[model samples]
Target chain A: MNRKRSVWFLTLFSLVAVVTVFYVSDRPSPFDGIQLFSDDTLDEVGLVETSSTNEESFVSKSNAFEEMRMEVTEKRSQLRDQLTTKVGSNEFTAEQKDEAYNQIEELVKIDSTEAMLELIIKSLGYDDALVRIEESDVFIDVVSNEQSTKKASEIIYQVKREWPEAYNVEVSFDGQ
Target chain B: MIGILVVAEGANDKRIQNSLIKTLSSVLQISPHRIVIEEMELEDK
Candidate 1:
């Protein structure tokens, strides 16, 4: 009985193997029609929709830009009116007036540090003193003969006390 | 008088600036419009 069972199991295994091979070899695979380089179906649909959406976006952005430009222009005109009125009513020292004019000219050039310094020095009446400029910063120091060393020191002290942004004023006393 | 510049960021900044100007005008005998105020928005980079 054991020998008969073993012969039946062998016959069943060989039959199953033969059937699987026949099934595999008989028909084309489901992936046979696919091509790696073919146009993607979903991307083509999205590309058409995206192009139309971009047109609308561009138009909306352009309108926004125009609105901003017009608003800025109106604001500028209003500011100019205010400035003119203020200038007419305000009273400034002669030095302040000169500095104001120089500042306007300097501001037009985008950078007027040198012109600003010149105006500052002249306004403070320190043009004759030695001026040192370093990296957008200015230092004022008095240079004089031995007899005037004390006077120079006093002037430096006075300047430091009076100016708002004065941090670099020095006076040499008798070369010491 | 020395120039005073105030820079602020966005609408909240404008509200704070307006409140400050109102208070200063009421207390310091200064005109509200005379203060130099500028507005700037924060940048990502």
Candidate 2:
């Protein structure tokens, strides 16, 4: 009985193996139907540039205002970090750390002052603006529909109102 | 000012923008021209 069963199993196994071999041996690749190099798909996809008429767009676009702001922030932050490192390092004396702390505080105050001035300028009716304070000079450039003397006067008035100091203020506008 | 800041986002338009800008200017004590509703991105809202 065992010998007869073994013979049947061998016959069935051989038959299944022969069928699978014939089924896949000469068949063209089934993936041939898929279009892997279609140009139409690429043509349908394109870049979408951000186009907005707000301060957000002014800051987001690859423009001078955003670049200037980012550069200022980067440089200030790097300076702040160096001061922080000096304050934290064990090699520094208490007096040195105190000086570093004072420098960091000054940096913070400068950053806050610049931000406040910028916000005030933006609130004063310009589309967007950047304010930079260097020692005794306060530099500002704004965007608006008209860059008249009257508009510049209004901006200077507002800037001085918020920041009352003897700093030499310079105002410029771009009617873009 | 933004329309979405006052009313529903989908209902924002030119009229709504003008209205919202005035409202924002008055509330924030800022000039209307300083606030551009059209240039404000929805995601930034």
Which pairs of residues clash in candidate 1, taking residues 3 or more apart in a chain or in different chains? none
Summarize candidate 1's per-residue lDDT along A116-160 as a digit string, tens digits. 533444454432233433333345442222436556565555555
> Among these predicted structures, which one has the highest DockQ?
1
List of clashing residue pairs for candidate 2:
A53-B39, A54-B39
Over 4 Å off, model 1? A1-47, A89-92, A95-176, B1-45
Which one is best on TM-score? Answer: 2
Candidate 2 docking quality: incorrect, acceptable, medium or high: incorrect
Q: What DockQ was computed for model 1?
A: 0.03
User: What interface-residue Cα RMSD does candidate 1 give after superposition?
Assistant: 8.5
Worst 10 residues of 2 chain B by lDDT: B2-11
